[model samples]
Target: MLKPEDFRRSIVHEPGEFLAILERRLRAAGSSGRAGPRARLLEKLSTCYQLVDGELSKAEAFLKKIVEQGGFYAELFKLEAGVEPGEVLKRVKALRRAAGNIYASSRSELKSARGERDAREAFRAGVGRLVSIYRRNRKTLSAVRRVALEFSRMPDVEGDLRVIIAGMPQAGKSTLISRLTNAKPEIGFYPFTTKNIIAGHLPVEPYGRIVLIDTPGILDRPMRERNPVEHRAVLAVKHLADALLFLIDPSPGKYYSLDEQLNVYRTVQNMLQGKPLKIVLNKADATPPGELEEACERVRREAGVEPLVISALTGLNLDALKNWLTGLLKTGTRGF
Candidate 1:
């Protein structure tokens, strides 16, 4: 048998199951994702996956690639929906147009801010109002961006990322999210605590400036089913997030055991649809160093991705995680 370490180092591609499913569905529908609704939907899904998986940096690449592929995804989407993705296509085009506007406007405003427009109290007030303006005009703001990131695009109404944090209810999600960011999802030792999505921002000094998002935790099914709140959190991540933070604890049932929480990991592994993914090994403080290392090795062998080993309670490795995540901001390439 392949040793855990051996498997960990092996080069296995992260299977694009989600994309394949969408492709297959499109084929069944006989539409193919050809530059229409089918195409736009696939692009949207790919962008969403990138955001949820802590891989937003890769999103534009995926979009650009799809576009270059001459509407492969568009055909696929059309194939799946069995309808002209005309409406979806229009929305996508409009979103792209809006992205250009935001960038242009930001450049002008950013320049004014630097050129003394910011010297006056009015400018200061304007800057202060950006957040609220962002909150109030969030729908329009999100409307301009191709990929969803901030709260403006969030379902139900305009809100912040704290909305996402409150949604994660797993044992360590709140603790970790609150510790790393300001969203504060109500930390607790017990399960089923966070009943909604709480969002927070991780300050980044990337070179000098950047932003990282901390999302709610996700525990696999079964236990999640036991708590209706958790199920909603999972669904919300699927629908709203640009990426996901999936946490697994083997002995999560008791909190101190070393059981390899394969169930939750497996559940997410299958549901993942070419989305960028981040695996988190929370409670690293609770386990022995060697045990945590071994657990990580085992997961790497199976999951084929590196994990963020952390102790939310003591803040161990949290800084590193934040820095690492901040490096994945996809701001400049927003519209592709």
Candidate 2:
């Protein structure tokens, strides 16, 4: 997993603001040193070049990691930023290279200068060129900051077993994960409350850890028609889920019809591609027994899989669901 916390903590400032701070540091360093005027000027110029190179190098390294990791970070940058991580990395590297070339050319000129004045002029010109490069790529630098901040908000899923709880709007997926694990996702009586991937953990002794992910509500639509929130669920199902728990709301007040929910299920099933999928019928407490049985029969007839009935609200048959999860995970067998 590409942990967002691994990103650099250095605050990326606006180019002008960064230059101002660097000038202040140079002034203070010069005032505190006991060197001649020419020596002080050259020393500050050297320090300025090093500072610019270091900052650009750090940003380039972080962007490279995001590209190389190519898991959640890469997908997220592509989906949200509308650009690939590698593309952004290229821009950063270009800025660094431009600055490095300026500094190298200036250093060569300084070595061949006839006097201190010429050397000072060349060094100052190089410093100004580096600052120009930084200022010209303000948008690129801001993108680095935006990526770091966005990734910081991502959920952490550092567990052994990764299970995605997926379903239509108001399907009680969030409620069920909250009931089963310590994660308390924002629950509401509406659609699409989970706009991002929320993770909950349950440790099963020596058997290892189980990570339950609650995904945003997915409507039955084409991938191009899906919103960013729904697309995030699709991405998680594709990349992160080791197993899936598809929750179906069969109550009278369900948001989407059984046919619609099944359509979404088929999409997720395609993403799973034979991964372990546990179909769970939620809101059993609110549903009539006859209607619930009919829904179960419908699911079995259409999806060709039996579903476990449980009420996420009233904790009906929840213990059984937990036991099944633990047993199946422990033995690598699929049965209730």
lDDT of 2 by residue, 1-336 (tens): 866577745336668778887888788666866886666666776777777877787678777888888977688778877788798888878887887788788877776778888978987887788787778888877777676777767778877778899999899999999999999899998899999889999989988888899999999989999999998999899888888999999999999999999999999999987888889999999999999999999999999999999999999999998887787579753221
Poorly placed runs, candidate 1 (over 4 Å): 1-170, 203-227, 250-260, 330-336
Candidate 2 overall Cα lDDT vs. reference? 0.84
TM-score of each predicted structure versus truth? 0.44, 0.90
Residue 114 displacement (Å), model 1: 74
Local error of candidate 1 at 173, Å?
1.0
TM-score computed on alpha carbons, candidate 2: 0.90
Clashes within 3 Å, all models in order: 44, 0
Per-model lDDT:
0.44, 0.84
